[model samples]
Target: MNRTPEPELMQIPSQVRAYADADFSRSDSMVVKSLEKFLKKAGRTLNKNDLIFDMACGPGNIAERIAKNWPFVNVVGIDGSKEMLNEAENRLSLNLTKNLSYELIDINSIASGEIHFPFKADLLVSNSALHHFHDPYCFWGALKKLGKTKCIHIHRDLIRPASDEKAFELKEKHLSNSPEILKKDFYASLKASFTVDEVSQQLVDAGLSQLEVFQVDELYFEIIGCI
Candidate 1:
């Protein structure tokens, strides 16, 4: 498998990040709803005792939701941006329970052994954040380390194509019916997203043969693994 050079660190603009934080906080009816349904269907039990890490966790939206749904599950939301982390901390506080927290950490650094969290997670999850990684391989390596029992990685991002026209078509059709928020998200995601073949090849290169990759929707991908 040929590895692509890691992309540069893609910083989320403050305005965009703020918009995302607010959108996630208020709009729980779409992907978040689907996510809960999916988790239930998968029979994932989040108990208070289990330690779960939300990698690239933005404003702790997913983390808070998970914590609320499974009051017993301990959740730690990790992000690289201090601003996002601060917002996440504030959000976590408002929805405070005993089992949730937030931390600021760079995903790539963690993957390269420059930084370490004290605990190994029972489950490592992220939403729409994987595409932001400057080094996707490092992200995968970190996931490999954290995914001890079950890995339920749900990413609702854009899907790129191997070729130019396919990519354009995907964007055109996908954006046509989407809401404004989704439109912005879709384009950004498309620019940042990887093709299924690309991600599959990466898994193979990473020696992660046990990983299962699925196209959940034209705009979403689900990657699952069992340690």
Candidate 2:
């Protein structure tokens, strides 16, 4: 499948609402499990007062899970989509986590240094978000800004399949129960994703060669390391 980057923001109200209300528990549970397993492998632990920053946190699904796992840890989810953020805030309000917050920020602007986060991030994580950056440089630039010395960084996204047929097959296998909109979104994301070699080269170009890029599962690859 060729790389076809989707729009950075989910601008349509219905689309955003549909995505927010979609049941992603099956896939999201896999994300949280992978995060915990990899974080442990990196020899890090979430401190009681630690701050976690999740980029492109659509509807706060993954961020909510992180907050739940470590009740004391603070979580901040940043996204450019107002509708998505609104949905995230709504869901968060219904939860017990007072430490999880949502922010309306353009990640590209933040990556370009046009905007800056007020506080230093203890851990920076992004899941299934990297593929949305039409310009890979923006993604690398953002990583450079977030990946400070001693700050843990881990990013995971679907890997582009070798063939379009394979991409469709994977989507059917994984997202069979999902709504048509979400299934379409997943297919688009898979096509937009960078291959292993492409991502490795991106790391090298960004001076992030110290980080490790590895295929973590059948359909996903992760870029993980500390700065």
Q: Which one wins on lDDT?
A: 2
> How much is 72 displaced in model 2, in angstroms?
1.4
Q: Summarize candidate 2's per-residue lDDT along 1-227 as a digit string, tens digits.
A: 57888888886887887788887787677767776887888778888767888889989988998888888898899899998899998887787588899889998997888999777678888888888889988877876776556877778888999988999999999889888888888888898888998999988988889888999777888877787
| Candidate closest to the true structure, highest TM-score | 2
In model 1, which range of ten residues has the least summed lDDT?
Answer: 1-10
lDDT of the structure predicted as candidate 1 = 0.66
Poorly placed runs, candidate 2 (over 4 Å): none
Tens digits of lDDT, candidate 1, 1-227 = 22222333324565445445445443333445655665677787656667878888777777777777667778888888776777777766675667888877888877888887678887777777667765678888887766665655544444565555555567678456645565555555566777777788988998776766778766666666545
Cα TM-score per model:
0.77, 0.92
lDDT of 2 at 34: 71
Estimate every model's Cα lDDT from 0 to 1.
0.66, 0.84
